[model samples]
Target: MSPHPAPDPLAARLRDVRVDFGTRTAVRDVDLDVPAASVTVVAGPNGAGKSTLLEVVAGTRPPTSGTRWAMAAVAFVPQRAAVPDRLPITVRDVVSVGAWGRRGPWRRLDPAARAAVDESMERMEVTDLARKPFFALSGGQRQRTLLAQGLACGADLLLLDEPTTGLDSDSGERIRAVVRAEAQRGAAVVCVSHDPEVLRIADSVVRLVDGRVVDGHLGAGATEPQPA
Candidate 1:
């Protein structure tokens, strides 16, 4: 008999994860596994702890209890609101910051890194805005720039919060395409979104309610791509 093939390794895992803030619990009793080369969408109404759970998976916020494990490199693109307005930084500067993880601070980007930044901006259709100030862009433009930054990171795991929250059909579809491409390239992608279009492209969907998972299953579009 032939030996069984090994199971694909997980990009991240959360076991009984929980988070608390003084009197409130943001997330609790959660267990999730992120497989490589796949997209997992977390969906829920407002205040359902979707963003908080994403932060835990990104390893940016330690859970009040439970365990979280993820790959070494991670790119987290938060909602545009999280970014301060009127920053002096340019769009190119923001995208280049992604490469800093590999090149470190105060160091010039190598030719390959530069190419990645340029390519990322192009992919997000932000090449034209490269010289523009980050704060000067509209909401959709800023979101695209941020996504380009995340793409430039070349991380094994990508985490995004409401990547397509508010945008025109074209911009939203472009982002969705990029997200699917990322998974195809072997990165584990986790997104917090309520967009029906987003849910349609996800391989799996985990729903949350009151800081706990209420449902988890294959997405409706798991076997095929849905029209944008």
Candidate 2:
């Protein structure tokens, strides 16, 4: 990995963001910068738009009206496991979804693609489950599969929503470690969770309250209005 600038990393910038669910505003004029290789954990009370913020940033849910820009490649792992129970695919196959962009239209798997899938499984420590049925795995194992999916994307921006939800302490810690490792690898990782453990791994914090950033970073003098 190249030595990137410490102060300003290639990042995803949201300018003048606003979103609403009917009359209920989920996000209002929220501006944020998600920098590369930095863990920015978002925490807040219920209905704070923790998940919505991540979704908008990932381009899954576009802001009702705003300029959201991602300067580098990005991917998302939703709170729910995306694998279908009856798909009959294997663990390795689950991770390979990340490479769909590089796979030409209707192209079959080649040696290089297979190798990439293998590496993603290895990184998640699920190589042993490579040929195993994806639905047959436990929740922890499925979460790891999702982790591998994001990693396999080889993107500089990764968005994870409540990754540790419903996970035991051990599995949650293991997942947190992977998120930290992602940041150390020059990828910006934003994890949305109410768990303090999630916030502990963040280099910076964005505290949201009722659909707005109430505070920036978890420190003194951070209550100023943030760019949206």
**Candidate closest to the true structure, highest TM-score:** 1
RMSD of each: 5.7, 5.3
lDDT for position 7 in model 1: 36
Quick one: RMSD of model 1? 5.7
Global fold similarity of model 1 (TM-score)? 0.92
Per-residue CA lDDT of model 2 for 92-142, tens digit only, reads 777888776567544676777767777877877888988898988887788
Model 2 accuracy (lDDT, Cα) = 0.79
Q: Cα lDDT of model 1 overall?
A: 0.89
Number of the top candidate by lDDT? Answer: 1
The residue ranges of model 1 lying beyond 4 angstroms of the native Cα positions read 1-8, 81-86, 220-228
